[model samples]
Target: MPNPKITTLIITYNEMDYIQKCIDSIDFTDEIIVVDSYSTDGTYEYLLHHPKVKVIQNPFENFTSQKSFALKQAKNDWVLFLDADEVVPEKLKLEIKSTIENTDCAAFWFYRKFMFQNKPLNYSGWQTDKNYRLFRKSKAKFSDKKIVHETLVVDGKSGILNEKLIHYCYKNYEDYKSKMLKYGRLKAKEDFYKENYFNYLVYILKPAWKFFNHYILRLGILDGKKGLIICYLNALGVLERYKELKRLEKKNELAYHLVMP
Candidate 1:
């Protein structure tokens, strides 16, 4: 049988627990490129021993820069980007192998099955979460956004894949909160730099509205306690982002006055 003509690219930062499983699932790929962020954990050591993996140590920049760097490193014309915390299911792996062999589409989006604390989230505004993961190397690249969430800038046609990729988001509230704080700070800094000021209404009302939309309108309440937790966290994330933006603006204003005066 002929080997699948695609490369798998994964960007990592201390993702030791999930890296091996993610790698094992994509055994069909012709090449595997792992661009790491100088992980102090055993992730680097394990990748070094893996015969199939090409490991490159790049210091932490942002998502877009790191992913764009990884895209350039891929040997195959076709590429699949996988997060270290996400696992490609067996059926999805087979589907990817077959789809790439047959289809001419430049990219394929797959449904991500989100799991929170070992339970699959059937509701809670997470279902039908599709992301473009498979694409032609030359046709797409990561946007130059220095932030937590970076979108793919694709020039070619894109389609959807049938199967799903499992995403293990957060084990508990603490994990969610930690990410919220970090991402909020980064997002706030980005907004502040762009001169996007935070309004009183936006800061307060937006979070409340988001909670209502996610938990009530989206039927997140049907999922029980987990749903409520997800909604609360989502709202908290919004609030933190606004608060961080205000703090950043204040700091910048103080620095400017000090330097000028």
Candidate 2:
């Protein structure tokens, strides 16, 4: 007749600025498990001293492996995978507490209200942005197939929370651009592993379509300047992805020729 205990899990690297607030927001959780990727910016030390936090310093690997490792460290059956840059609002905190107390599904999806430069982004293909943050550890897991944008596999039914998670996704344009470029490179590597091929035509179409789809079809125009910047950078990220993909193909070709007689 007692409510199930919950563990708030977060994998972080150089997230000192946001870590404190993130933890402060979720202090209601029964336990907080943080799997740090050997952060050098004093983030590791900060978490080490936090009484509520149990920090594990693991070598920097792909997102999938890191998250999967964090998932296993949960002491309770209910696990919430939270990003360091995200904060659980009071309403969301209350919602989560009540949900787990009466949850019927194996997992719960939380829609994120993304923030850019402290402004909430209402569109730009973000209206439907959701992640399976709250879930039963035994019923959900991070799949190791795609390393960068890792997929969460849920064995049973799922539910969606009414309150949106407040996600401070990007501090500024430069910050967002740098992260997206890195993501693009990682995505290219994933595609390379799968032997996915794309020609010159893809380079032109993908980025163009990305911009058009998000800005136009997704009603990003309503968000004005913020939406424009996001859509443009998103397309740039696609271009970066394909550019890296092309470079990878050429590198492989060169290696094959060198090895051949």
Candidate 3:
């Protein structure tokens, strides 16, 4: 078999439960490069022991920089950038191998099957969720300084893969809330850096709008309880984003006052 070697790159932080499963699914790759953010949950040690994995311990600054760094570390031009919480399906593996050889595209987008707390949400604004995960290292690059959804830029042509990647996104209630709050804070920092602060009115209206947009407009009602939970949590994440944004605003104000003598 003429193998077009692929370097699978992953950026992780404390993803102990899912990391091993994520790696085990991608056994077809040429080499696995795991960029871990000093995980204390035994994830780093496990990857270090794995024979096929080339584990690198790097401080996670943000998603964009970490992913960009991972891209540069790829030995092969064909790179499959995957999250530690996501698993490549069996069919996707075969599809990827075939497409990399047959297709002339610079990069490819893969749609995901979103799972939340052991349940699948068919709607809740997740119907068409997709990302450019498979791409040529030389052709694709990530947008700078985005804390979440660090957009990937493809230079040439792009296409979508047939099979969907399974994303075990939210494990439980507490876990989901913690993640949303953390993402909201990170996004707030990015916004603060870019001088994109919002007003006091946004604190209430934005969160309300997010819930309605997801649950009502996006047809989240169809997914039942799972959909309701997902939609509520997603809206909560948005609320946290604006709350953290205000926190940052107050923080800088205090610092400015203290420094002025």
Candidate 4:
């Protein structure tokens, strides 16, 4: 088989802190396309001046819509999606190039190592991170109905790569808090719309289960302080989602679902 060319796609909002490094890491790609959500943090300005980067400005929506827009802008048949906070290391880049050249699979998965302040966390349920980031553009697309965690839809065979993709998750507590709150609210709203609302018992047990599953069952304790922090935060996020769902249901203010698309 002939070596295939690939395009790198990224979606961003206020990701200036990680955007430059993320883009620099994927310099081997045939083309890099960034679809920004009119970021006010100068992220758009930086990409605008980069000679090798192509920038497109779009309004902020959910993750699925933003990524779907980026997918359409890709110029090559093989496309790799990278989060603004993710960096493709040299070893992974070489593996990716080699995979596209020899594999006929529709998509390839990469293990991700989540980083906290430049250190990797080998526990906290993060060690199991695997994402399908590389795929043939014609055979794959992101699901349209998701709000928080979006999934890719690949029409054919899939395979996995041995290298790890580095994810610079959050810079600090403030960053983590801000993102989790947003995610919690979005997930709650999605649950409300789907009529998956739960009662008090569920609200209480769900968070507990999340903590136990991630911290104890997943061996998050082995990772020490940072792992504990991650596990607790994960539980708190779950509680917040259920609380938000109940709050909206009590006031009968679920009209927001009508406006969401």
In model 1, pairs of residues that clash are: none
lDDT (Cα, tens digit) per residue for candidate 3, span 94-169? 9999899876899999999998765777888888999999999889899885768899988999999879999998
Per-residue lDDT of model 2, residues 1-261, tens digit only? 898999999999888878998999998899999999989899999999999999999886688988988888898999988999999999999899888887679999999999987898899998999998999999988887898878989999999999999999877888789978988888888988899996889989999999999999998898899999999998999999999999999999999999999
Q: Rate the local accuracy (lDDT) of all candidates.
A: 0.86, 0.91, 0.89, 0.89
TM-score of each: 0.93, 0.95, 0.95, 0.93
lDDT of 1 by residue, 140-192 (tens): 87776556687887887889988889998876788788777777777777787
* Residue range 123-242, candidate 4, lDDT tens digits: 888877899899999999888667788889999999999999999985888788778777888888889888886589999999999999999999999989888888888888898999
- After superposition of all CA atoms, the RMSD between model 3 and the true structure is 1.4
How high a TM-score does candidate 1 get?
0.93
Report clashes for each candidate as comma-separated counts.
0, 0, 0, 0
Candidate 3 lDDT for residue 31: 85
For candidate 4, the clash count comes to 0
Candidate 3: worst-modelled 10 consecutive residues by lDDT? 115-124
